[model samples]
Structure formats: C-alpha cells, structure tokens
Target: MATQTPREAPAQAGRRLDLSAPWWSSPRWQEEKRRIRGELAALEARITPRRRLRAVIRTLARHGLLRLMQDRRAAAPSAGDASHGRHPHRDPDRRLRQIGRRLRLAFQELGPAFIKLGQVLVTRQELLPDPITAELAQLLDRVPPMPFPYLAVVLDEELPDGLQTFAWIDPEPIGSASLAQVYRAQLRDGRRCAVKVIRPLVDKLFQTDIANIARLARRLQRLLPPAVAASSDLPGLIRDYYSSVQSELDMRIEARNTREGRELVEEFGTLAVPEVYLATRRVLVTEYVDGWNIKDFPVDFFTFEERFERMIDLAHLYIKEFLNGRYHADPHGSNLIVWRHSKKVYVIDWGMVGRMDALHTEAIFRHLLHIRLNQAEDAAEVMLDVFEPTPYTDVGRLKDQLRSLYIRYVDTEQAGPHNWGHLLVEEIRIAMDNHCRIPTGLSLWAKGWSAAEGTARWLCPEISYHTVVESADVQILRRLLARRFNYRANAAWIAEASELVATLPRRLNKILERAAWNDFKLPVEGRLSEQATRNLNRMVNRATLGLISGSFFLGSALLAALGGGALDRIPGLAAVTTTALWGSLGVGVYTVWRVLRSNKA
Candidate 1:
C-alpha cells in the first residue's frame, strides 16, 4: 500500500477459473453498474428515494436476483428478471454459485454501501456458501479510486498549512481504495510521510446510501418469513457494520488507530507501525513505511526459513497486540509490507482497526484456550458467559449448538494454522442463530485474525499458524497472569478489599443487634406489581362468577324441590334449570379460553 505502483487489474478479471468469472466480466454487470446513476432529489437527501428504489429493482432484475424477493415456489415475477431462478438447478452448488454471482452483481450495481455489504457477507464465511465469498471477495478494497485533483482539493482544505505544509507531494497516489487515497509526501522538517485524504464528498455519499440500505434491511426483515428473518437479522447486522463504516469515514479515527498501533509496536523489534504526524477530519499524515507490499515483495530477499520465521513473528506480534486490546483489523497483503533493508514487517493502513476491552480480550483467549484443551463444555461456558442473549435466544439451544460446534471441531481435520479464524467465524454464526448481539470488539477481533492469518498464508503457505499461536498462548497467558500480580494493576482492588475487611465486624455486629431486637427481617418482593395485580383481579372475577352460578343453581333446585312453594310463582323449573346449566357452561368455556389466550400472549 506504500508503493508507487499503480492499481492493478481487478482480481476477478484474472480469475479465469473462478465460477464467477463469466458473470463478473459480462457486459450486463458493467452496464448495470454504470447505468442509472440517478441524482438525489432536492428534497431532504443526497439521493432520490424513488429513483434509488427503482434502480435497485432494475439492477436486481438484470442480475436475476429479483427472485430472492419473490416467493420461491411461485412463478417468477418477470421472465427476463427471473431467467436463472426457473432452472431450480438440480445441482445445489451451481444454484448457489448462480445466486452468489447475481447477488454480487446486484450489490455492485447498488453502489458503495451495497458493495460494502458484500464485503461484510464474505467475512461471515461460515454463514455463507463458498461461492458467495469467492464471488464477492475483497470489495472494500476494490472501490474505484477517485480522481487525484478532487482529493488534492480536500488535502489543501483539510491541512492547516495548505499545500505549503509539505515540502513536496507526489500528486500520483501511492495507494487508493475504500474510503481514501494515499499520496507520498515530505513534511517541512524533511521526514517523508504518507498523506491520506478522504475521498471528496464520500461522507455525504455513504450517509445517503446507508440510509437507503437501512430502509431496505428493514423491509427485508418484515417481508422475509419468520424463520428466515430470525436466521439472519438483516437490520441488526447492517446496523452493526454501518456503525463501524461510519467510524471509518472520519480520518481522525484512523489517525487514532494508527497512533494506538504505533504505541503497541514501539517495543516490538520485528514489527513496525507508521507514526502519525498530523491528523484532521479528512486528512492523515503518517510516517511513510518504506517497503514493498507484502504480496509483491521479492522472493529473493529471504530464505524459506527466514520467511517462515518472519511469518511466525508477525503472527506472534499480533497475538500479543490483540491481547493488549487493539488490533489491525485489515492486515491483508496490501496493508502490510517487508522493509527493504531491515527485513522487519511494516504494518500500514491502520484505518480499519478493532478494539476490545481487556476483559473481553481475556474472555476470547479463555474461550479459545478451553477449546484447545478439548474442554468443549467449558469452552461453551466461557463464551456463554460473555454472550448477551436476546428474547429469542434459547440458552439451552445455544448450549447444544455450541457443543455441536465443538464436536465438529474435534472431528474435522485441522487446516490453516489451527483455524482460530474459523472458530471465531463459527461463534459469530452461532451468535446470530441465537440472537446474541456479540460486542463489535469480537467481530473486529475475528476480522483481525482472518486477515492476519491470510497474510501469513500468503507469505509462507506452509507456516504453522496453530503452532505459532500455541507458543504465543503460553506467552500471552504469562503476561496476563503476571499483570494480576502487578501492584499498580491491582491497587484499586486491594483498596476495595481492605475497606470491606475493615468494616466487616461492625456490619456483622449491627446485623446481630437488629436480629436480637426482632427488627431484622428479610425484605421480600411483594406480589403486587402491576402484572401481579392484574392476575389477582382476574382470579377474583372468576371466583365471583362461579359463586353467582352456584347461587343460581341452588335457588333453582330448591324452588323445584319445594314443588312451587311460592304457589305458581315459578311455572317452568325445567326451563330455568336448562338455562342456568347452559349459561354456566358457556361462562366456564369463555374463562378457560381467556386463560389460554393470556398465556399465549
């Protein structure tokens, strides 16, 4: 990402063997993306609501994705739009692949927000078909770069000293993708740095697009069946991801991420992070990490053994850093480099970062470690302790599901560095299934692992990710255990404990005195809450009804037994008996129905 190289061909273009290549390169997709760029209506937004809606439908149709909207068993809505849907494609893989291609095309056509959505979908790999992830791969990085002139205007406006702040700046971008463009420059003091400028007006664009996306997600939530809606809380997922995307829009946040990373790596000899020089809402100035992008780093520079060592070192470095509560969320090849001379790894582009509190990070480690030790139930307990279950969350079901995952993990062959990334993803899927709103920190943690593990794979395909992490686990645990014994870390806890001990005897004596005086009574919650009151009133009403019915029966039976004691006052005792019996039966049936309905509600 810190090189002078121009953007390369789209990864899809070079993937001839990809199941998605045909749809990706199709003229239809190109036209769909370019066609129908509607201007926003003047009324309260950056995009016209109606045009955006139609454009979505049209794009979905063009890509044969409208079928997703229509009832699956029903006939296609339009022959042109649902051409592929009719096939039913007896081969499930082909059907999924086709759906994946169409969905990717539809997302691309919908613009930046949807493309970003596809990127999120790929991250939940366990929840998606491989075809889907493969087709929608690396979308965040694939957002087309904006023209340099516009970005330069942003730079001049956002920088305190204007263009004169930099001794010289190469207008040509060293890297550009997602939300910003990177230009190489030298500060007034002659320290070479990278100037990252947010793409002009992207803030407004993302704002408008995300608003529309939320609208769509809401509609999907309502329109989809209960089972489908529960399986994927579209609105909830969009909200979580968009919150992070919104954070990414502000360059100051990215600068802060860089600053935090810089601090963590200061003590790491093998790892380096760019130092932040200056930051603004729209611009970031940081030390220019001089190295070849990891993917393109020359093969001749290191021996296989050295490459393996660096890979292990990189993995270990992130493990420690993440446990400390900050991680580079997108450590892909482009955001990483190998220093030309020092041979150390340079982590660049700290824009997309994930952070967790110490407790959560410790929980994640404990969860994984339990799994490593083959204590499936303990691992489940560790995670369940952290998961925040929802109204729909079945704790028992969640337990069963988590245990099943453990079983699968045990049965499956281990591949790809012990597959911690895989486990994180599975947890996410399980969380979603049970309506557990896991902290964003966990999502970011998983993202960090996925990207880091992937970059490790790219550097040394034979690298042992699990083995590296096993050693890392020992070190990580050691550091945590040592922190517990640190006086500084436990000062507040020790103070609290001391106070509690000092007050113990006094508190106990007061309790005993009150007990002897018959003044110490357990405070029990009264069964007089609003709901409890309502239930009591309903019971009283039912009892009164029964009392009235019994009185009527007794009166009628006495009258009949006395044989018209009132001397012709009651001529139809049989009719009276039948009416009372039927009426009482009706009342009892109604009461029973009411009780059942109330329980259901």
Candidate 2:
C-alpha cells in the first residue's frame, strides 16, 4: 500500500482567543481588523442607499478611516455569485426573522457590551421580533477576560495600596464577560470569595459607542418599514441599554443587589444565595459557590434525566419565589449554580432584579393558567392588561390581531411547540408599537419565567408544560395570597383601620343627633357627585371585605392541606375531600379551556 499521511485536526477554536495575554498586545488584533474591513467591503455593495449611508457613517465612526477602503470589487465575484447577493427568500417573515438572528450573532461576535445588550434585548421580548427575541435569548457572555496584568492595574488604581493587603489572589478568572471579569481569591482572614473587577478605561469608549447607537436607534425608529418598525420597540427599548452599560461600570450596585437577593431567597429551603464580601467601587467580592453549572453537571454524577429534572425543578421553585416576592431577576445559565453537597441551587449575580406588584403578579398566574388551558380571549385580556393599552385603542380589534399573531407564531414552530417567552415578547412588541407599554416588572418577569420554562423543557421532556405551569401557578398564587394577608394585618393597615373606626363613632354621633332633632333629612352633597360618593364607599367596603375573605379562605385552605387530623371534623369529610379533588380538576380544565378560547378566535 502507498504511504499516506493524516492531517491533524485543528486546535480548539477557543485557544485562538485566550485572554491571559493582553488583547491589544495580541497580533490577533491585526487579523481581526483585516477581517472586519473585508466584511465591510463585501457589505458595501449589498447596502441600499440609506443603509449604505449608515454603513459609511458606522465605518467612519468606528475606526475614523474616512478614505474608502480598497475596493476589490473588480477582482471579486459578480452579482450572480452566491456570496455577492442576498439569500433567496421563499418566506418574507422567515427572512425578517433571519435578519434578527444575524444581527444578534453579529453582536455576539463583537463581544462584551454588545453581547450584554443582546442579553437585555432578549429579556425585552415585547420590543423585538419573535425569532430575533428567541435567538437573542440564547446569548451567553463568554468573552475572554482582560490579561491579569491589566486587571492588576485596575485593582491597584481602585485599591490604592494593593496585593500586599490581600492574602491570596488567583491569576486566572473563573468567568469573564464583555464588561467585567470574576476571579477566585481569598482574603487575609482565609475567607474564600470571588472578586469581580471591571475593565480599565472601558467606560468612556463604551459610552460613546452606546450614545451613537442610541442616536441610530432614534433615527431608525422613524425610518424602518412599517412592518419592521412595528416589529421593534426602538427608542424606549434602548433606554435601559444605556442604564445597563452604566451599571456594569459600578460594582457597588451588584453588591447591593446580590445582598438583597440572598436575603430574599434565604427563606426558601433547597435554594441558597451567595454571600457578598467587601465591595469597593470597581470590585465586588462574594462567597465562592462550590457548585456545577446546572446544564453541564457531570453525567457521571447524575443520570441525564436526573440532571434535567433537577434543573427544571430548581427553575420552577426559584421563579415562583422570585415573582412572589423579589427575584434574583437574571436567571441565565451562568447565574445558576447547582450545589453538589446539599443538592440545592445557589443563584448569584443580581444586578437586574425586577419588581412585580400584586396586580401584575396575579395577572401573570391568570395568564399562565390561560396558556395551560389554551383559552385565547382570557389570555388576550390579560395580555392587554399586562401591556396596559390606552382607553382610546380598540382592544377588541387588537385582540383579534393578537389572536392571529399567536396562531401564526404557534403554527411556525415545529410540532406546534410555543415558547412563552417569545410569545410574550411578540405580544408586548405589538402593544408598544401601538402605543402600549408593559410595566418593566412584568417584562422582566416574563423573561425570567421564559428562561426557566426553556431550561425546564430542555432538562425534562416528560415534564409537561401544563403541569409545570399549574404547579408554579399554585405556589406563586399561594405565596402572593399569604403576602397580601400579611399586608392587610400590617401596622400600616392597623393604623388605617383604627382611623376608620375612630371616624365611625363621630359619624354615628352626627346621625343620632340628626335623628333626635327630627331633622333627619341628610344634606345632599353639591361638590361631590353621587357616583363619586358611591364609588368611594364601594371601594372601602370592597377593601375591607376582600381582606376578610382572602384571609379566611387562605387559612381554611392551609388547614385543609397541611393541618393534621383537621379533616376529621365533619361527617365523611374525607369522602367530601375525595370528591372535591374532582372539583379542583374541573376548575383546572375550565381555566385551560378559557385560556384557549381567549387566545384564539
């Protein structure tokens, strides 16, 4: 046989982008510049008149290379070449979705702030294309960290007299993103923690780039095609882009958010929060969690199914607890840590917590049940309320449109599997384009839940969406009900109730005096409308009644579910409980039915 030689496989692609060495010092910068220039040149011919103008401005603004780069068009492929023209579009909607995906991919390749922006965009699903939103939701901040030397410089500047002050510092970082890098280290007292240090001089350049992007967003808000513009949230959407960028620059906020999240999740068993250590302007130190990434947990440690189920269960619990009270807010895979010893989830990094009020949280459960039951109209109403449309807007018409949109989205996905996160985003985007704005809390809640849902589905295919939804709905609602009951009994409520009681005696005295004088004819109020007086009294009655009713029902339910031997009080109450299980099933069935009807035509 003839002698043959085998070619070696290429080195891991990641090895090419090592961050241990300073990025600017790497000769790779030249290669990247060349690559970008080449891409820009190729992109030039495909650009429309306006987009070409944008391209030119962007190119100049990015590199200050005013002179048109070498035009290799003469040597390049003609328009007939596959690389020279746009991809064939059999379906325009698909093409639009592809555009969104491509844009997100571009941001991913750009690294850090852009990747963070993409992460934020996915969370703001109501303001972006469904396909785009879905794709962006997959964004992970996996950029290489700055060289240790540069990081050392940052620490030195921020710490005043440094290194000698600390007992031990790891030269390598555990996790790195576009904005900040986290390293494992120990204090002089031998306490183990991770120090997250921001990049040096990243703010000025990043802010400038962001300001330019903001201006571009404004211009595009006015210029995109009707369908395209309608598909995006634009200006309002990018408002937080700047805020997030500014936030990443300060580590103090992260310290505070993490501390608060720890306290919030502390009450829950099987869930833990990382403890924050010393926090300075540029660095935040927190207890190092000895846990595995939920998704990447070793199969040897647990079966595939076990891994998946645990992740899903963790997500369900965390989300319920979060929406019920405060949330870790951002529950991306990176933030999820599976503690091996206790088999609990330790969520870290809480810079972007979302607040859900009573009304919004309740509406979310209603929406979830609606989805589980597939009741289209009820779902639509909840969507409208969540979006908070204007009175002048034709909700009926919008509902019809939303129903069609939902059908299209559901139909487009394989096997008719719908992602709630993407669906919510689409619904929100539609509302925003039509002058509706969903509360930030609701949007974040949707994002967090969608992430949990997606992770759960990925972990356990046998875990039915309906079951997950129902379980979460029950727990969240129960917790919220408890909180409401507690609030009604709070000192504030006591004071208000006392004042109302005190007023009752004076009002009674007036009534008695009037009756005694036989001048019982009540003076008609002229300033206030009868309708206003009636409404106010009705509200007061409802508040008082609601407090009493909710507390009683909640207590009864708790006693029935958990109080040992309490069920034996009534004659054949066990049999009644057995029968009542059927009633509960019927309610669930009806709830799902309502959701389907409301969500569809």
Candidate 3:
C-alpha cells in the first residue's frame, strides 16, 4: 500500500531511531536491531517484488508479448492493411489470433496466479476483444499434475488418518488444475468420492504471484492511459481477484459455498453440487460427479429442448439465487456437466461464486426488465445512478450511446442471437468510454454472467441465453417491485412522509410570514441552453464587428467630405477617398444584416 525504498528504513526513521551506534560498539538494543536488519536484508534479497516482476517480464518476452503488453494503447491492425493470398504479412484477424496464442502461453508460464488471472479476465468480454478473450478462456489449469507421492505427503500432514481414511485412491488423478488435483477414491465407510488435494508449492507460488500481480497491474496501468475511467480497473481487478482466490485457497470455504449452493438449487432436482464428505484446508472429498461437460455433451443424441430446459434451470439458479445473495460465478461447460444420457445440469464447482445485495439485485433486475420493455432511457438512467462518474465521463453522450445500443440489439423481429452478457457488457463499455466507472464488484459479477451465457450459447445456439432468461427476468422483476413497494421496505419513506405531513402547517405559516414581509426569494440554478449560448456568442461577435465597421465607415465618409481641397489639387486622391467610404459602408451594412439574420434564426 505504501512506497518502498532501498534504504533500511527511511531518513526520517533514522532521526527517530538509534542508528548511530556501530554494531560492535552498540548497546543491547542496538545490537538486536542490527541483527534483525541483517536478517531482513537477507530475506529481502531472497524474495522480493522486483525479482517476481523480472520473472514476469522474462516470461512475456519469451512469448514476444512484452512490447505488446506495454503498448496496450496501440491501435489494432485493420483488415484493409493486409493483402490477400500470397501476402507478405498476416491479416489483422490472424495477427490477433497469434497475439492471443502468445498471451495464453505467457500466462501459463507466469504461474498459477497469472493463469487464474487470465482465466477470470477472459470472462470480461466487455473490456477484452473477442479473439484475445477466446484464447484466454481456453487457458485451463494445464499445470502438470503433482505426483501422488507428494499429494500423499500433503494428505498425511493435513488429515488425521491420511491414506488410511480412504479405502483407496487412484494413483492417477482424474482432474489436475492450477490449484488442485483430484483423484477417485473411497472412504473406509464405503462412500465413493473425489479427493481434491492442493498441489505442493502451488499455494506458495500463488501467494508470491499475487503480490507481484499488484505490481504488474500498477506497471501495466502506467504503460496505458490515465485512470480517468475505464471498463476495467487493473489494480482494483487484481485486488478483487485476490480476495476471490483467497477463498479458493481454503478448502473449508469451498465446502461451505458448495453446501450453500446445493441448498439454493434444491428446488431444481436436476441441478445440484456434488455432496461434500470431508473438508479441510489442504484437501476436500466430495461425491464424484460422472457426467459429460457441455463441450463434450452428445449433442447429436440429445434434443435441443432438453438442453434448453437444463439451461433454463441454470439461468433460474443465477437469477433467483442472485437475489438471495450467492450464485456460482463460473458456470462454464467444464464446471457444470450434463448427465451422460439425461439433460440434468450438475454444478460441480463452488470455489468461486458471485454475491449481491438488495440494491445491486434490484438495479440489475430493473435494468434487464426495462430493457426488455424497450425503455432504453430508463435502463440507461438506472446505470447512471449506480455507477460512480469519472473525469472522462460525458453524461449526455453516455445516455445517447447506451440508448442506441439497447435499441439496436433488442429487436424482437431479428432471428439472430442477442447475447445478454454482451448486452450488459456493452452497457458498461459505453459508460466507461464516456467516463462512467463500474465498481469492481459489479465488474466481477458481470464476468460471471458472461461466462454463464457463453455456456448457455453452447447448449442452445437456436435459443439464446437472453431469450431463455427473458421470462424469468420478468417474474424476478415483479417480485422485486412487490418487495420494493411493501410496507416494511418503505418504512423510512413512510416515516419521512408522516413528518412532512405533521409539519406542513408550521412550514406553510413560516413561508406565508416571509411572503407577507416581501422577503421571500426563490433560487434557481441553470446553464445556458445550446441555442441560447450560440445566439449570445453570435451577438457579441457581431456587435464587435459592427462597431469597428461603423467607425471605419463614418471616418471614411468624413475624410471624403474633408478632402475637398485635396481633391481639387489631386483628382486621384478624391476617387480613392470615395472608394474607401463606399467599401466601409458596405461592410457595416453586411455586419448589421448578419446580426439580424442570426437573431431571426
């Protein structure tokens, strides 16, 4: 949070400390301080933010992305610049794809923290372009699995009985990701489950990378524009990510989240989380889900209706649970699997989730409902009210842009897909472009929504996520409105109203007394209207021109009349004086006409 210096402490600190004593001649306290300083110096040398930053740079440079990362503001290559077949260089799309590949590689090389960052960042389609986000979305936890022996070491250290508690663990892991590796196992009680053990040293690496991540975000932000306003806040995003990742770091939290998720989705029989058996910081045992991820689901064998229904359930899960305050953040294909032959949607991941309060829940609900009703201005207004404004923001322009996007995308006549996630993102993106800053919490939740819609798209390309959720959105909005108007919900408003009514007579008397004394004054605050402003400026400029022209005309006319003697002596002089008078008069008349025309306009 504060700046670092190369010195042991600071010059000011030395003024307040006993740093004057040499180590050998020092008193007990001074000797202790010197010893502590030496240890601190050694530790700093061994592990420092600078060292981690260098590793990041080296990895990026290896992937040929260091320059690209620094030059984030560079305009993307245009299609027109690229030649066709047998061209000397690649097209813009091709180049973008290449950059995405390189970025994915660099993130993988950066360690778990960066890989996780990339994974989460991809969900923010509003900020990142599609080609890049597509590649990053594919940046899975492809880290090589930690050996079973090493995992056993961790299990032995964390578990009371270790391997003995499990009837048996498959030596081969069923799932290996950046954070943990999962294996099929059985408890002594004959309960079959998946054992998820944190990979050795990953926790340490993630902690280190997370610290360096803040530094990296700071450096990258410097390489770009000022933080007037942005669709994405790099430092804030990193901090939010750190908090979310922190929860994942603890297995107990994940278990609690899973339990909570299961309870929320209990109404939908097909949608559920794998049962948690044993939970610990280093390990978690849960019922092993056997199903096909949406990506690999047998599309040919299943009907679109089945897929659509399952997706609806997922959407309801989010919409309903969001109001309740928690929903699975990452509902991507891998995280939620489809039953092998059935269309049951099983949510299996709970390490990360999104939450909302009454304000945000209502804001989001109303925004969506208003957009559905084609009340673009109201939706735009809702956003304007929720987000904090930044220096770059133009309120009028933001409203205009958001209104245009809403009308363009929400055409019921159009058969083309209208992605709800992209629509939401566009709202944020336009707001950001006009200096409307979205809070980090909202941004994080928006990404989760984006991922959910992306998965929905995969399942029902014919019926988009928006179409499926539209009806549900209406119901949710109705409930929201009901609650908003409920007596208990409006207690403060009712109290304020009652006070106003009770004091009405006294307040009116005061106003009447002031009016009787002729001392009442009304205050008005207004700005120059565009039309008025233009007319006022025009009048001032024309008046100035007319004044100068009129003076010239009068002077020329007088000079012409006064040049009688000179004219008799020199005929050319008389003619020149006449021309000057006529020209000045014409200019004066023209200036007057312009002023009149402007006033009429």
Indicate which candidate wins on lDDT.
3
TM-score, prediction 3: 0.70
Give model 1's TM-score versus the native structure. Answer: 0.66
Ranked candidates, highest lDDT first: 3, 1, 2
Tens digits of per-residue lDDT, candidate 3, 407-449, equal 8666532134455666777777776667666765665577777
Ten contiguous residues minimizing lDDT sum, candidate 2:
1-10
Tell me the tens digit of each residue's lDDT in model 2 across 1-601. Answer: 0111001101221222222234423455435445544654564445344553465366444542232222222223455655423644434346445555565556654445567777776676655556766666656554655666556556644764454335556666687776778877777677878888887555644555566677778998899744345435577667756775676578888888777776766656657788887778888878888888767766577666665556546656666655655665667677778777876778877766666776676676676556556577777777776666653345677888777665544322211356565666666666765655467556777677666666665555565554555556666767767766876658778899899998999999999999999989855633444467766776566456545545545555565688658677667766665555555555545545644664631
Model 1 lDDT, residue 13, Cα: 27
**What is the model-wide C-alpha lDDT for candidate 3?**
0.72
* C-alpha RMSD in Å of predicted model 3 compared with the true structure: 14.4
Candidate 2, after superposition: displacement of residue 542 in Å?
Answer: 62
Which whole-number lDDT from 0 to 100 does residue 199 have in model 1? 71
RMSD to native for every prediction? Answer: 12.6, 25.9, 14.4
401-432: candidate 1 lDDT, tens digit per residue: 89878755542223532366677888888887
In candidate 2, position 535 carries an lDDT of 65
Pairs with steric clashes in candidate 1: none
Give the C-alpha lDDT of model 1. 0.71
